[model samples]
Target: MPQNIVVSQPEDLTVAWAQRVVKLHEPHTLVTQVDLVSVEVGTTTRIRLAVTYHAETALPRRWFVKLPSLAWRARFITALPQLLETEIRFYQELAKAVPIALPVCLAAQSRWGLGSILVLADIEEHGALPGEPHDVLSAAQAGLVVDGLARFHARFWHQHGTVPRYRWLAGRVRQVEDHLGTVLAVPLMQQGLRRSGAAVPVGLHQAALHYARNRRRAMRFLSALPQTLVHHDCHPGNLFWQQHQAGLLDWQLVRIGEGVSDVAYFLATALEPEQRRLCETGLLARYAQQLHSHGITDVDSGQLNGRYRAHLVYAFEAMVVTLAVGDMMPTASNLELIRRTATAVEDLDAFAALPI
Candidate 1:
């Protein structure tokens, strides 16, 4: 079961967080009901809250609120403008011309010492997780997701030299690799393998060391790719399908990176190994077709296959991530961390599974 990770608060709360949410969103009328406060994983304060509007309002909305941790907020005081600027830029790129559906950016706010909050339109639930572990997505739904990726990427194809501003977006992948290095990398690798009843194979540590040394090369390889607006973490957990539309959420890691990185990370982490094994080629072909529809006819099937290989550049990232988060492990999460590490390396050896 997923734990509702909540923290305690004193009754005399000085800051009016509740009022702040309403003001940030510009409520059509004052919010009358705010219940179902559920906490989510983050180094900072993140929650999903349901807000009911005025007495007659029927179309109530859910908003996902993400705020920095108290500690993070303190360090960000001096650098506040830069941090907010980067975030605004990302949202602008994703929102401007793309016809795809993302959580509408209801609000992005910075209240000085209180840090920043990004309030997003929540994708409503029909029900939580209707699909089977390997239940296939309907053809149309898959097409929308893959097409969305292609559209976002094709926007940047040849504009590399011309659009100087977008050049740095390519570096977002490096920022990701760096962030994961601290929170999810080495420690989880050491932990996940041993817990899965998988032996710590010989040369594991050496391989890890080598991977670290070549980390720059791996990052460079991604930076070398045609950068585009990538929804860096688009696993099934980050996606929700409702009738004819699909809602893509969780934009914290959104940045400019290789398009394949999103496809790879999403498919690898979201699908069962069996599902990925069966559908990898088929999905890639479809995504390529979508690219073609958008006039990106330069890439052939051979180059498409190459993106599959390049996805492995993020294998270590996925391993640590699976360990850091729950649900991947059967027993103790931290204990099983070692198992996830070994399994990630296993995929590195085998040519199966998405790089995610």
Candidate 2:
């Protein structure tokens, strides 16, 4: 494949380039015209392409292309090579092995200074829809997501030490610790805190402030727990759903950590307060049952409950830091995530449960 075929902009997606990429999946098809259906820019750029194939050729009408964002903020944030590398590697190496539903990567590539590009099958064409950050998940939707997560975590559970192939997935906690100072200093942090302050309990807010000072110690404690492959960024915006089926997107933050982090983060950030309060215990129980069915018998409800609480602090800090440094445009969603996560922390007494 020619390197020039990899593009950073929609204009660069010529018909020839489109054909080359589509041919990787459909050899006999010829794309006549490539229309730019939609463009969504964030930490990454998502371009939807509507292709007109030659008559009698069998090819999908639409495909989704993911490339590094051209926006100054997005490019600056994703400039960290590992951030793009992780997602590219996930699609290239691990996406097939995982049992959970995720987008099918038709093609993907990552270059150090140049941006990354991922061509994926359009799940939207098949009834899957990306989740909105501000929208809350109902009980049924949350259950589907939890079930998918259980399968994903169980597949890679306890494999970190034994599998050399997974060595790349470690060090997520350390990475967060290293970047905490810069993240805290971003101007959006104060604004986000202020916007959501009323909904955040005093104890939880105090814990967040204190946790900032001792983040290293807190991360160290969590890292010492049993490890498994986690979709470290499992909040609402990174998820997709269709009826009973839930699909996860954005593999950039995938890492080795306590699997319950995904559970805690997803439930706390994605569900409304009353809905979360009603469904949380039952969901946790359901997850435990799924884990057991998948042959992970060492963890019981008590251990999961404790770890889940501790992880609520981790999830809260992560959301705050991410909102602090990343796209501050979604202020409402950022505030909701912070407020809901803080509520979970208070409800669970997560700060007290932390080893620090």
Candidate 3:
């Protein structure tokens, strides 16, 4: 394949293209074969590849590649916002500066009409375990993730505009996405709640409906806080575990936002309600302390708690919206997340925290 050639699906990853990508990292190596080990399609198509080299090298045998979704609905949802493109940009431009573990980018490229390709070192090859959406985290595991996110948030704390290079983190694409989300909020939320059946408690339906009706205002309220780089979709499935350390994945929703939003989303989606109730306060304190250790000292525990409670609304909405969209995640996972987030919202009175 030529330098200009960009693959759009697992089948397009020809040996020639594989060689071309490999040669960039290992000058002496030539790819002899390319085998598609497995492929999973959701909002994006994740392809696991096995590459054989002509000569001995230290390069990984397996590689992970992400492409735009093959599912039409998922593709349509992500296309306008250029979610995969944004993630490609993250790998190309900012992955190295991140504090926690992330897959090593081997090659990343995007073209407006040609689509995008992200080649990464398969973390499984490095003995890391990928987190599944249905896996509930123990309090100890959730605490580790909270710590990792704190370090990440602290490094980029309040640096949104000051860092000219990262100004795009809060750029127009996010604004447009937020606008579209608000526009679709009511129908999607209603549909999701209906689809949720008995998963969401009856008591929370009116509050959820009201929040959906006033989503634009709710969005504004959520953003009216100190901003930092956040993994806006911080559920368990988007994480990987290695030696008890949590590494983040799925940068498609990475953007500038209140850092506590990540904490709220993670806890709501990642933990069992009982476990979350037991450990969230301590984990939150640990997050603040981690931020302080990283020289971010202005965060107040009381205010942080309020922000966290408020942010749980988005977490609930996100899962509901995912369910509404369909095909974006497993129905079972989506329902469970909706259940957990709904419970969190009611438990914390998350909607009350919103200005609306």
User: Pick by TM-score: which candidate is best?
Assistant: 3
lDDT of 1 by residue, 1-356 (tens): 21121122312111244444555445555666666567643333446777666656433366666555333422232132234334545665546655566656656654434445565666553332322222245445666777778876787666655777666654654465455454434555455434334434555655654454455555556556655677765655567665666556556555666677777665555544555556667888888888888888886887666765566436445544444343432234323333333443455452233222
**On residues 137-254, what C-alpha lDDT tens digit does candidate 3 reach at each position?**
9888888999999999998998987989898878888887888888889999999889999889999899999999999888888899857899899998999999989999999889
Index of the highest-lDDT prediction: 3
Indicate the TM-score of model 1.
0.71
CA lDDT of each prediction against the hidden true structure: 0.53, 0.77, 0.90
lDDT of 2 by residue, 193-255 (tens): 555657566555556666666766777787677568898888888888776688888888788
Candidate 1 regions with alpha-carbon error over 4 angstroms: 1-28, 55-59, 69-89, 111-113, 125-144, 164-188, 191-209, 321-356
Return the candidate ranking by TM-score, descending. 3, 2, 1
Instruction: Write the candidate numbers in order of decreasing lDDT.
Output: 3, 2, 1
Models 1 onward score TM values of 0.71, 0.90, 0.97
